[model samples]
Structure formats: structure tokens, C-alpha cells
Target: MSQTIVALDCMGGDNAPGEIIKGGIEALKENKDVFLKMVGRQEDVNRELEKYDYDKTRVEVVNATEVIETGEPPVVAIRTKKDSSLVKCMYMVKHGECDALVSAGSTGATLVGGHVIVGRIKGVERPPLAPLIPTEKGGALLIDCGANVDAKPSNLVQFAQMGSIYMENICKVKNPKVGLVNIGAEEEKGNNLAKETYQLLSNLEGINFIGNIEAREIPEGKADVVVCDAFVGNVILKMYEGVGGVLLKKVKGTLMTSLKTKIGALLIKKELKETMKTFQMDQYGGAPLLGLKGLVVKTHGNSKAIEVKNSIIQCISFKEMNINDKISKKLAVKKEN
Candidate 1:
């Protein structure tokens, strides 16, 4: 069987080796073709592994001398912390030593290391961090979540193509609808960026260009791919998080307010938890810095083991889907214009 090797940055996320290590084992146990290379302090990794005696051959460890902190600048960490676990494992992906690199490290550092070390795919103008966000109808791919916040209309045009391909291929949304985010459904209702982007996207031939979608319509499944600058994308992502969190707390508080309600909560606790899973960003794993030469997934810094492991596996899906190549083809189409 071909090796689905994943180079894990063991020191990247909040849970570190503890949760990441356990999640890796679970992933390998469920899939025999999978292999993991845990990159971190060797002693610490091995000590954690001693607790579970699974298939030892499927897992290996590579020690790194330094660990990059979340607070450090991304460019500096990628350069100065060359021996850091995040950088080392990333290098492996760049050189094809591993199929993918998963890290819950600093976004800046990951972006810098990915571009400076691994590089971006040919014909990719600006690599966006595209993550799958679950919606009522499965999920939607939000590109340039934070990569190029201050993007140009041309950049947004490209994001529409990239996001379209991702939703079509990886997400399996055939002829996925594309919408440019605006203050309202009108084309002239937004700032210079949104208005110009709306015009550009309207003329773009590659995507299934749906009309503008307001932020209010996101969860209602108005469109599969919403193209915009990173600033707007980031704001939407944060707003979704804030709303989901507030709602969860409100429901819990309401349920615990009375004995009768508490009883109802107990009866529906499992269902509620399942419902929450659909909205949990962590459950969807980390966001992918799309358009790079190699796969680089940046998870939340506070991510646990499952999120880290799933992010690693998520790269496998990205590779399998040929997302980068699809984006490249779309870009080539745009270049002819």
C-alpha cells in the first residue's frame, strides 16, 4: 500500500504531544495505510508514546532543538527557528519527505515558513488560507480568512476561482454557487473594495457567480463559496464564533434554570451536543493555507489532539482532491483575460 505519511508538528498546538500523540495513534489505528512522523523533542515524544503500545512502525519521531512560540513573528520564526519542530516538519513537506505538514502554530509563522520554505504552486497569485466551515448544507470553503486582508479586486477575483474549485472538487459541490460578500444584495452597496470586486466577479467566466450575499445569509445556505478580502472573511469567521459561543452559553444557562428544564436538558443533552458539533470550528479541524506549493494547515493555537490529528488527515483529503492544481487551472483561465 502507498504510504500516507503525515509530518506532525508535535509542539504546535495547545495539547502538544499529549492530545496530538493520542489523536495520531487513533488516526493510524483506523487507517493502516497511514504513517506519522512526530517532530518535536525526542525524549518527550517517546515518553508519551510509552503509554500506548500501538503499531510502532507506523509512527516515528524526529527531534528538533528549538520550539517556536506563538508570540514570535512568523518570518523570524521560520528563519531563526529553522530547527524548531514546526519549521523542521514543514521542511520535510517542502522536500517531499512527507505528504503533508500539520501545525497549530502561529498563523504568521506558518504562512511565512510555507512560502519561504515550501513555496506556492505555480500560477497561484496569492495563497489563501481556505478552511471548511460547516453549514446547514454540509460546509463552505472560506478562502483568504486572514492571509491577504487588504486584497485587491483582482485578488478577490482569483479567490472566487480558487474557492469555487475547492467547493466543487474537494467539497464535492458540483457547480457550486459563488457569491461576493457585500453590505446588501446590491452590487453598489459596499465599499470600494467590495463594489469593485463585485464588478470583477460578475464578469469572471470561470465561477458559478451568484449575486451578492449579505453576512446574514451565510448560515441560510445562500451560497456555497463567498469571495471577499481576508479582512471581511476574518470578521465573518470571528462573528460566527462569537455568536455560536454566546448561543451555546445561553442555551445551557436556560436549561439549567429550573428542575423541569434540567430534566429536559438531560433528555436532550446528547442531541444538543451533536448539534453543537456541527457548529464547533475545532471539530472541523484547522484552516488550510491554500495556494501554497505544499500543504500547510494552521489550527487554532488552543486546539486539542483531535483537531490537530484531523487537520493532518484533512491535508490528505486536500491532496487527494487536487485542490492546488484545480486552483492553478482556474488561474490560468483568468490570465488569458
Candidate 2:
């Protein structure tokens, strides 16, 4: 059996060692072949770990001198906190000690560390944080969710290629169609950057470039992979979450207000619950930054133990698919000639 170990940053996030510990335990209980190197303060990790009966032999704590806070700048923190758990865990993956790295810390730090410390692929111009967004059909991948806010046309073109590769191999979307998030479907629409990107994507020979996709069609699952600059993509992500939250709250309030509605709710509650579960963001876990040298998953800072658990198990699929090697091979070909 192949050795699969994931380096988890336990010092970061609000839940820190507590939820991280629980996530590790759940991961091991679910997958006997995988192991975890929990990186954080030894005492804190041990304290939280004592609550679980997980395989102690399979879990080990890697100590760090400091913790990187959300307020600090990512570069300075990574450089100054040389012995910090966040930086150390990334090095572990960079040096080939682990298969992947998971963190629920500052998004800036994770993205900076992933691209700078672990380094990008051979020919990748930029690393995009591709996350699954809930859609009316199910969910779809949104590339450059928050990595590079201002990207070039070439950058968007590259995203299409990388996103295509991911959707095909990892996401299991055969010949995944690509769409450029734009103001309109007209070739003349959008800013100069998007228009230039349109030209590039239109010429691309590999991916199936579907024309411009409007934001309204997003819920209809018009495309399998949606590519946009970080600015727009981040807006779309936040809007989806906020809208879903508001809708759910309104629905719950309506059902609880009256006895008649309560009885009606009991009748339709099961269907509504299943519908809510289908669009649940927590169940999808975190987003993986594509085009990195190794698998680096960035979970939401507000993620609870259950979300973290699902995030770790997501790594199992990455390992089984050998995603990194496949990415490297593509980058090599792109770099050569």
C-alpha cells in the first residue's frame, strides 16, 4: 500500500487544535491507510487530542515556535515565523514529507505560501484557488476565486486550461465545457481584459471554450468550469453564500411562525431539508488551489469540525488520483517547445 500522509496546520483558524484534532480523528477513523502530521504547539495539540480515541500511532504532533495571526502580512509572517506550524507544514509538503497540506487559516497566508513557498508549476503563470460553488444542477468549479484579483488575458486563458485539466481528471467531468464570466454573450462585451481573453480562449485548441456565460445562467449550470479573474470570482462566491443564507433563514421563519405552517412544514420538511442539503456549502468542504506543486487545500476560516473532516477526506481523492504528478506532466509539456 502507498504511504499517504497529510500535513495539517493545527495552530491556525478559530477552532485551532480542537476542531483540527477532531478532523484528524475523523479522517483516520474513516480511512485506515491515511495518516496525519498535526503541526502546532505540542501541549495544545495533546490537550485537544486527549478527547478522542483515534489511532495515536497514526497521528503525530510537529511542534512550532509561533503561530501566524490573521492580522499579520502573509510574506512577513512566513519569513519571520520560520518555525511556525503554518510555515513548517508547508515545508513538509514541499520537501516531500507529505502528500498534501490543509489549512483553515488566513486565506492570504495560504495562497501566498502555496505559490511562493511551495512554488508554482513549471509553466503556470498563476495559481488559482478553484472552489466548488453550489448550482441549481449541483455544483461547479470557480477558478481564481481569490488568488490574483487582477489577472491578464493570458492568465485567464491559462486558467481555462488548468481548470479544464482539473474538471476532467479530478472533478470527473468528461470534456468539461468552459465559460468566461462576462457582462454579455456578445464578443464585443466586457472590458479589454475579458475581450482579449475571449480571443485567446476562442483560439485555444485543447479546451471546449463555450462562449461568454452571463452571471444569471450560473444557477442553471450552463458550464462545467467557470473562469474569471479573482475579483469577479470572489464576488460571485460571496454572493452565492449570502443569498443561500438569507433564503434558508426566510424559509425557516415562515415554517415556524404558525401552527398551520408548522404542520405543513412537517409534511414538506423532508423534501425541503434534502433540497437545502443539496445546496449546502459546508458539505462541499474547501477549495483546492490548482497549479501548485503539491495539493494545498484552503478551508474556510469559519469552518467547523464536520467541514474540516470532509476537507481532509477530500485529500484522499487527490492522492488516489495522483493529481500532482498529472499537473506536473502538463506543466512540463507546456514548458517544453
Candidate 3:
């Protein structure tokens, strides 16, 4: 844990090398143990790097001439764009040159590179994209948020197992409750996939599998790990974000509507801001593609400095905690049991 090296895609996000480089520098300044290998075009990355004042020895600029656009086909892009920032960063993680990769690039490209490049851990059917979602009690890890859209029941079962390990180690939620995302609370209420997954999870050892959780109950912090296929998980994630954004906007608008409310807002602005900070998604960093040989994290494509900084800082814990090794051991024991 002396130094955790993270390969960052500087040319992949909407903000590109500017914000991306800024985040990397911020992460270095924040975490004295982190060393960043920034990947992007030489001139672009160098230009951005000149603006930041940080330890010179801790930062390395890796040149990657090509850039992968979000519109490009992920599989094709990964194969063809050999010198793209995203692909180059993925390879660094795969080859053990870096402990992890952080990208605000194309989701499709990240997933594709993770599987096709970094590869999956053995005995893992499908690697899941698990992101911590804020809730009443704390945060819940939503597994398979945008990977494995057609995941089988077995995949969901693994998601629960992997997610439990993540919450326990990273989030420090001991014996985290795992819930199957479903329409009704009953075991027999969901479709074939949910019903089957529920049965499998109910009997799974080492995880605290709760019964079905309705969508409404998610915000209530009903479960620490919410398991579902990518399609359902993606829909729920998007809806959760959209609703949260609208609600925050509405509250801010209401606070400024009248002089009276504005005065009241001033009285409570500090407390309210502190409370709201807990619910911000960027604070949690990017979603980690679990069950891979090397860690691959995907942030929003429009990510700014804060999210990128947090994402790089997050890699230190993943490496120091030895998450991939823990996952391999957990799955291996489960198979034996």
C-alpha cells in the first residue's frame, strides 16, 4: 500500500484532458499514496498538466493518440482503436502496470475493455457494475447497473455474493442485507428471473439475503445490496438519479421563491448543505466493474474534476483491501460449499 498506481483515461470524457488531469492532480494532493498514470494525447495532456502544481515524480503522462467517441461501437472501438486513451489505460491495468483504471469514457467501451482486455475472474459467470446509491440509512450497492442485461439467475446470485463482500469491506456495512429487486415483497410475485433468483439467494450461504424489495422501498434503505439484471438495474439507477436531481432542484427553487423563505434558508443553509452532501453520487466515486482480474471503474461520461478525483482515490482502497483477491477466494469457497 505504499503507492497505488491508477491509469486514468484523460481523453475519454466530455471534459477531456482538462478536467480529467485536474482530477488526477487533486487525487494526488489528497492521497499522498496515489500515483497517477495519465493517458491521452501528449500535447493535450501536457498542456493540462502544466496548469496543476503537484509532485512531479508521482505523475506520469502516457501518450495515447486516438480517442474513443461515445457513438462508436464499443467492441469495434476496443479492437480498432489500439492507441485510444481508454484502451491503453485498460491494458495498463491488465498487464499489472497499474493496480486499477478510472474512466469517464463510454460505458460500452469500459465494459467491453474490462471483459475483453482485463478479463473476468475465473468461476465468475458475469462481472457486475456495482455502484453505491445513497439511501436513508446510508448507501446501497446496486449490482449489474449496466452490465449483463440478460443475466441469468445464477448471475444475480453471484451479484449478491460479490456485492455483500463489497459492502462489508469497502462500505464497512457488516453482514450487509441483500435484496432482490422485484415488484412485490412476496417470493412468488416476480417473473421467472426474479423468482428463480430469489430462491437461489435464499439458500445461498455467507450472505444475508432479504426477501423481495419493492422499488419504493429502495430509497428507505431497505437493503444494502440490491440485485437485478442490467436492464432493470439501469432503469432503476436512471430513475433514481432523475428523481433525486428534480427533487433537489425543486427544493432550491422553493428556497429562493420568496424573501421570507430566503431568510429562513439562510438560517439553515449550512446544515442543509451538509445533509445534501451525503446524498451526492459523485462522493461515492465511480461504479466498479466487480469480479475482474484488475479493477475497472466507470464514471459518468460528463464527469468533472470531483468525480474523477474521487474515482482515483477509490482505487487505493480497492488495491489496499485486495478486493479482487477477496472476490476470488469468496467465490472459490462458495463453489466448494
Steric collisions counted per model = 2, 0, 0
Error of 1 at 318 (Å): 2.1
Give candidate 1 misplaced runs (Cα > 4 Å): none
Which stretch of 10 consecutive residues in model 1 shows the poorest summed lDDT?
Answer: 308-317
How big is the positional error of residue 260 in model 2, measured in Å on the Cα after superposition?
A: 2.1
Alpha-carbon shift of residue 162 in model 3 (angstroms):
0.7
TM-score for each candidate, following the candidate numbering: 0.94, 0.94, 0.95
Reference-based lDDT, each prediction? 0.82, 0.85, 0.91
Per-residue lDDT of candidate 3, residues 213-321 (tens digit): 9989888999999999999999888897898889989999999999999999999999999998888777778999999999999988888999999889888888888
Arranged by TM-score with the best first, the candidates are 3, 1, 2
Which residue pairs show backbone clashes in model 1?
Answer: 74-109, 120-293
Q: In angstroms, what RMSD does candidate 3 have relative to the true structure? A: 1.6
Q: Judged by lDDT relative to the true structure, which candidate is superior, 1 or 2?
A: 2
TM-score of 2: 0.94
Top TM-score: which candidate number?
3
Tell me the TM-score of model 3: 0.95
Better of 1 and 3 by lDDT: 3
